[model samples]
Target: MYGHDNKQFFGNNKLLLPEQPVHDDFLDTMEKVFHWSCIFGVFGSKRYISILWSALILASLVVIEYLAIWKVIRAVTGVARDTSGHRSITARLAGTIFYSISIMSLFVASKLWYYWRSNISLLWAKVERSVGVKVPADSTLKRRLYLVFGLMTFCSMFEHTVSMIASVGLDCPSSLLMKRYVLVSHGFLFMGQDYSEWFAMPLILISTLASLLWNFQDQLIVLISIGLTSRYYRLNGFVAKLCELEKHQTEFNKKSEALKVYTWRKIREAYVKQAMLVRRMDGALGGIVMLSCSCNFYFICLQMFLGITQGLSTDVMTGIYYVVSLAWLCTRVISVVLSASGVNTHSKTALKYLYTYETHCYNVEVGRLQDQLTKDYIALSGMGFFYLNKTILLQMAGAIITYELILIQFDGQGQIDTETTPSIHLNVTNI
Candidate 1:
């Protein structure tokens, strides 16, 4: 019989999360591809690629990002000197620098993960395994993973597609882009451009793959969080069950009494262990999150400024490219923040129902769970710099808008000064 000492009618206290409703085909494929691993500890040497392979992938990404920087520098120095849409090169250079930093952060994160793989894997296993702590095979987590990965993938490809079309439609052929932009062979940014069907084909393929890798880092955090969040959710359900059991008096024998205590203890232990694991992950991967956030915030502000400075008055092709690129960036940044914030949002959700539990069901286990949740302040932070949440997303948006406006004013003032201010020529006389 189910553990019930009280005759209380057991009402289900399942807390449904309305925020993350998603499709999971994407994750199923990735699990098969990565062989169910994210942390270095999880990746047994059984992957299609080995340590050497991972290192090469990282090295290739670094090389590609470097080429992007080099290409931007080259472009600024000479390429498109005659082009009317010259202001874009400056924004491109700035975006390249930030993009390079984001790429390096992922590389660093990978190395660190490998270095501490053992400890992380241990933590991961503990939080994931507990009695009555199973997420459904068809849970929304899988679907969510699929949805985000798909949306981001589509957006990246779409942005690149638009840019290529604009470039070609404008009559700027592959040879021109190759001469102008440093054909970075790999990376998150769509910097590669070639008119040749053969040359453009490789660039297009690489850009898509690079984009997937870029998104994978942040999405990996989301994946881990979802895993942890799901566990918490199941545990909370048991707590609700405990509360319901107390609401109505249920008769039980000595075995039932022990079951009640054991189940209660397991629930509390699971919550604590899960909470600690979250803190540990925050320390290890905080920098990766920080770098991603910084890169996204900076580019948003910069892009907005550039977008306004060079409006529709510019050629229709360039205008189209601007809008598509900005749309992709905004989508990427918002999804990452919301997905990450869900961990914090959902972790503490049990509190809402915990207070409503009948007093008879209240015990030391419930007390501790409630107390811990209330004070734990569980959230993914950037090394204690900033926490991820929906509120933070709004705050960042406000800051970026303010910054963008200021940048525009500065740019406009400089242009006005150049046009209105008279140049004075000084004649030097030999004295």
Candidate 2:
């Protein structure tokens, strides 16, 4: 059938417009409208609207991803048979692409939202400093970093929430039963062999809690620094005199120098405190990373063993889980390495400033450099670095968990016969 202006029509009278329209004006108008609408929509949206939308979209994506993964778990554990219909290769490819894109978008949006909020907070801190308020060392930058970390934590909770929801909504009683069986069996595998599985849950929980704490530690430090600095400003004695000396270095070089020594000494004290904070953070982060790795490994082993012993036919869902889990593991490893590197970098910067101030002495340029370096150190120490590290870690964690689940389903189905083993008579004779 055909419609007006040679537009093809379906049997039900639905018009089938040309993919590439013949009329230039129509295409132009459509493009114009699309661009204008997007512009208006973005602009008309309130402040933080992007962050809100991004969070919601990302949360939805996490939910869907988890659901998809759960389907794989079902197939792997033999809790449910694979009912994947006759999906075209193209359709499968498209679905995979969409899922990947959605996951990537979730990550990107989270990072962007964190950056936006952090920048805003940091800007405000800078403004406060400009108004003659003593901004604590790295207060502005730390705030920014914390904001990002806070967002990452929020997103993680959102993902966990989605998983819990899906567990309730999509999972069947049979699947839950199967999961419980696997858990119990795994517990036996550990305990029955004189290995205590008692430490598993506690270790996992502690690691998770520590990870959260490590992520937000910088924020707490910044807040404390801000408060202390504010108090020092109000005291109207040593700190005020120091600030005055800092401002009038040219007129009062000798007096400023004397004040500078005191300031340097105070800064050294602060640096020592900062170093201790860093040490605690490092230990906490390291513990979390190790615990996460061990937990993931255990999960993978347990799932694989159960699937194999049960003689289940792991399906597409299992494959997805395996892929996701492995990916997550890889991410964790990368994050740990990056975090270590960042800490080293921060330490080096701090040391460099300390050396410059103590040895070369504080000059005009040195003072400025010291201030800038301090800010950078503070920023680096904040959640910004931790957030980046954790983002990678979480993604990897998710991927590893997913992949292992898939592996259990798919790899567990095929069994090798041990009864058909070759005779060892020749080897014994040789011995």
Candidate 3:
């Protein structure tokens, strides 16, 4: 099927290193982590240590949550009320869902890496080794990814550290048990048990720190995947430039019919090869994009709800920090969608350029390739459910706005009800 021509077009497949090896190397490392085997491998190497870490984190959060609800809130309000129905449940639910999706995304990303690793050698072998075509350096994309990674890391650390400190300083009744600050508190877990702050705080700190690192790594995997799309965009641009040149050459040299025919064939081959590579990679990422988009949207919506309902006046600095962290997270999802959309747009542009000129000699082949391009444009879907692109952000925006409006109406009605209720007076409450 044009085996020799494939070799001639792609040149030395063994030497298909990109101009930006560092970025490529970084992506390679991330791919290794994204593999599904790494999950079991962590248990194999660390075994009980990893289990202990998870247990400690869970325990700390539970204790903290219990104290915050039962001890602190009860003492302040002078009522033995159960805070189980607090709005924080929304956040907890979102976190749990996102964490599960994050784990699933790892598997998806791993499969993507596996697919790419299997086909990358063949893809490189088919790449047209043209001296005239310049491989663009994609250092800018790499830099932006790292910058986002850094922001995510910084925000996570800041949020956890401040929360930990605030938890410790929270005043509670002398009779209250579990006298330590924690990331969260659970009521049922502490119903019959008493634990020392000594045993809890250290575990909480270690678990919280581990969770932060884990989340950061997960996000890095996503960014790496997006970076590949960015690379695809650049490659598509290169092909488009080549097509433009071919169009001009055909316009000027009418006698060079054979040359024009061969050039168009090579261009078609290039497009086909690029499409195969991008399609396989994007397909592998299908589950990841679907899960991530759904989880991130819900997570962001929960954050906005909490931020709006939980008054900033309670702790001005803390509120601002929390809001900022939410903003950074929202940015990550937006960046990924935009990058995916960019890849699709570039591919369509290349297809348009391919059909921009027609040669009398290779008219049949050109038309065939053009038809294929129209049908085979690279698109990433959310696990066969929906297409993931810029429109995802718009959908999320609409949902968030609708939910906020509903929350506002409820809050106004609640305030009116409170104004009409009678107040109970406590006698000899203070010395």
Candidate 4:
């Protein structure tokens, strides 16, 4: 009688995600190893040796990027620098967005680092005390999170590397780059432009890599945590389902009773730990999520625009490379959204099971969990302003479509002007 409502409440398992711990663990490990490999590949083995050494290397890199590299390149090429291409309105707008997000990421990372270091111990204490639920430090999950930071670092490095290559190999002219202008590096400190391109190249590469690595690393920590927490929510749902099924067994033999009791306790323990992990993650990530998500929305949009523009290059390889890069970015964004949505879906499923059980057998803990579930569905909110969900994807799609249409119109108008210019000049001469 207790679980008669179970069948009535839940008939479909189509939306459920199957548990695959081995596969997940393998992926987690692989991503971490790949990320670290990128860091070591770009920088030398000594880069991670000491904070002081690392700081000095990073400072040197900043100088090269902001001051020396472009001048050296210009001197060697002996070509009077052309600023027209990168001075275009779209280019300036793109640069503004890039630097704004990048700088914000750095600032946010610093604050978050401080917060995480200071509050993490207290947060762990809270989790430990929370109904005796002690979530063990998941080394695998920790490594996976670190991997995300590494991946983001590698992405920044890859982008900068390609930009440098394109500028040299393809003769791509871009004035918006910091190395090209005398804004920060030349005026205030009065640094000289006497460096050779050979000297500047390595410095430029290292500096760009170092500057953004920490920023991206910081952002990805919050991002990956959000994703991991979502997965735990689903795990919680699975545990809940198992618990409900265990409770509904009709065969009440001695071994069956013992198994049921043991299983129920394990499920309860699991449910508690999973919930604690999600809550702790949410608490730790709350401050950065708002700004991060807002910035990410715009950043993703800008990236999409750049990707489309870049993909239209005359060089087939260049076009393909850009397309692949865009695909990579899209995959990351989609993964975040899907992870968040998974939490919502699974929590609701868990709630469904609880509600049905309540209809037949009244349990105080079930009612409390149901209330909590109803009140706080596992959604990531941006400073309580906007919730990250699949709907953001739809909004982004609409924005992309609108922007593309406008770009098409502008291109058509430019073509019309070019075509009619000679005729207009001829008519003026005749008059």
Candidate 5:
């Protein structure tokens, strides 16, 4: 029932095909190949490896900082109960030294990684343009890649060392108190259980260490997914441009038909064929968007559920996490709405441009139409859509404010060591 003949009867000059096609398997394979290629291409690059390493180092630094803070809290709480105070002082000093080293290493590693990635990507883009081909799988690229990997490994080593030192300095009582607060507060609001009570300090310590190790990998996966989605959008844009060019050629040929019918007709047919190819390319890109959206939506839902279920209901900690999560969700929704609107606007403008091209042909003055089309494209692409960007910025600002409010409500109250009353005798004399 889905046929081109049916499409021809109506004003729908657009090609019609069944949603489920015989080439579905082939299309799926191609899409997978595209994703894997992009992943490997980026990962195989020296720059990306450096970045990955730097990210790991940063994660390590975060862990080290947490440990150092834990140690300091223990000392303040007298959890170690060292009567001499010598052990506490030594642990604090050691933790501070290691944390400082980790922080400095992380900073240097991040800068180096950024510089390397940017420079390498720039060089590769130029080389690809010059060669008129995709980047080569070359020995030089591999060598550079190895160098980046080695650098990243070295940076990670320092961070790991800091984490190890911090681990050794952890005090049982301070750890228990911190765990109780975090678990009773965050867990009750989000996780629904006090992990500190359910699990002993040693088990909690092990779990924390495991989480630190795994969280970086999870973050990397997220980053990679985002990068792939961006690439899909860019590729779709290019394909759309090609389609517009072909449509332009077809219109030029139709107009020339008045003078030279046969020659112009052939040229128009060629353009139409090219346009069809571009349409197919555009269709392929739709799959990418669908997949990316599904993944993002899943993440959004999971995070929202966790935040609401565990975080909001907690009595001990103020509802800062809940507020931040809510704001983030709102920000994400706004971004999605903006992106969808932009894409729809782009599609409409493209169709309009095509219609104008077909109807006006060579006799039509296209400069004004082209200008309008360009403006529409710019607006639809959301490249300069500051409003949506600002929405996210404001949401983050709100999150910070909410966090501060929570802190002030919970921890900012002044301590009263003693109570005072007015002298009764003085008051009686005044009366």
Candidate 6:
């Protein structure tokens, strides 16, 4: 349904790429991810968009996704309780908190999407028709989307492999111990010692996908911001060209004032419309913005605390995974924060052209545009809790440093040791 012109992405009843390639804009690419596999986005077929289908799919999803999260959280919380080491227990709880945030992000984001889908689509169409100017394809936004997707996919796969390897033995799986380790990772076979691969494996897969919900939500915000930024840029350029043209007009072309005034009025309207679109987007995606910030903040601190306290494993694969995961996590955080911050940057940039553009005939449109960009303060936020900008990066670092100092002071008293006591039992699972 997301394909261009409503064409099938998979054609001829074969699960193969189309004969011709499909070029995806940022919105299309993001929607395609959720449409195909995302728990929240996968709805029933057109044949089943009725009440019965909605209820059935939503109910099944609740059982498979929400119930699974509760089960996993309960299982991990149990492990954390039984664990001997203070730091280890704290880390387990931190992972559970991070997981809970992911679940909530999806729940809220899905609700927002369903309720605001029409509003969002209308905003997109308005962008296309803004100021009677066409929105050119934004190649840069598409590239960023691809880069983000590549980094996230690699990060998730690498983390999953390392967590699996660390939980199981260093040796390849051949015996019952390795098999049991897999099930125990999800808390299905251990404690009670009742092993059922069937139930556990499916839930594990669903849990893994749920983990990607955070990524999906993050990328969606980034791409949408970039998308709006691109449109604002085009609007700015169009206005600038008019300003320059007016500045150089000859006496014979003085009648063009009427045309320029009309154009300026349109530009003013476009700028206002763009700003309104930001607010609409905020309402749709804002609920999860706080979750995005919180989860990133929590996970970065947890990974750093563990790396500093325990140091990386001497085992080469484990050590590499630790370092790479930490670095990749930071990259993801920086990418997301910067992407949204650009929206604020570009929104204010029109003021530069408005002030500097030497128009012979100044009009009320310019003043309105200037005031709209200046005092309006167009930026994404965590549902008005905090704005998304470059400052967040520093704020996060400072908070982490302060938290780490406290944790390290406690570690000196053996809160979390570099070497574990034989009494300690840790579950090496995806954080």
lDDT of 5 at 345: 40
Off by over 4 Å in 3: 1-151, 159-180, 183-193, 197-225, 247-256, 355-364, 410-431
Better of 3 and 4 by lDDT: 3
> Quick one: best lDDT, which candidate?
6
Which residue pairs overlap in candidate 6's backbone?
none
* lDDT to native, each model: 0.55, 0.34, 0.49, 0.45, 0.33, 0.59
- Model 5 spans > 4 angstroms off: 1-42, 47-292, 299-312, 316-318, 333-337, 340-344, 353-431
Candidate 2: where is the Cα deviation over 4 Å? 1-252, 279-290, 296-313, 332-341, 351-431
> All candidates: CA RMSD in angstroms?
9.5, 23.8, 9.0, 11.3, 19.1, 9.7
In model 2, state the lDDT of residue 327: 42
lDDT of 5: 0.33
Ranking by lDDT: 6, 1, 3, 4, 2, 5
lDDT of 1 at 102: 39
Give the C-alpha miss distance for residue 20 in model 3, angstroms: 15
Best-matching candidate per TM-score: 6
- Backbone clashes under 3 angstroms, per model: 14, 21, 11, 0, 4, 0
Model 6 misplaced regions, further than 4 Å: 1-27, 39-88, 134-147, 176-184, 187-189, 252-254, 359-361, 415-431
Candidate 2: TM-score? Answer: 0.32
Tens-digit lDDT track of model 2 for 23-79: 222123322322222221211123486445434444544553454455445544656
Query: How would you order the candidates by TM-score, starting with the best?
Result: 6, 1, 3, 4, 2, 5
True-vs-predicted CA distance for residue 151, candidate 2, Å: 5.6
308 Cα displacement, candidate 2 (Å): 14
- Compared with the true structure, what per-residue lDDT tens digits does model 6 show for residues 1-431? 12232122112422121122234365576555445434433332233444344344345445644433554465456743334332233433444554455557556756655654546765666455444432234557667766766676767666666656654547655665445444435442133344566655654555555556666667667667777778777777666655565565444244344544555666677777888888888777787687777777767766676666554444555555556667767877787789888888888877877887665567766777777778988888888988888898899889989998887888799765545321111212343
Error of 6 at 222 (Å): 1.6
Q: Which tens-of-lDDT digit does each residue in 1-431 have in candidate 5?
A: 22232222212311211122222222233233223322211122245664574455456546645754665576567774431321243334333443343344334323322432455334323322332111112223223333433443343333333322222233436645545333321221112242445433433343333222222222222222232223223333433443344344422333333432332332233233323332332232333233323333433433343344334453322234334434544443444434434433433343343444444333322334344335432211122322222244355446555654553444335221111100000000000
Candidate 3, run of 10 with poorest lDDT:
422-431
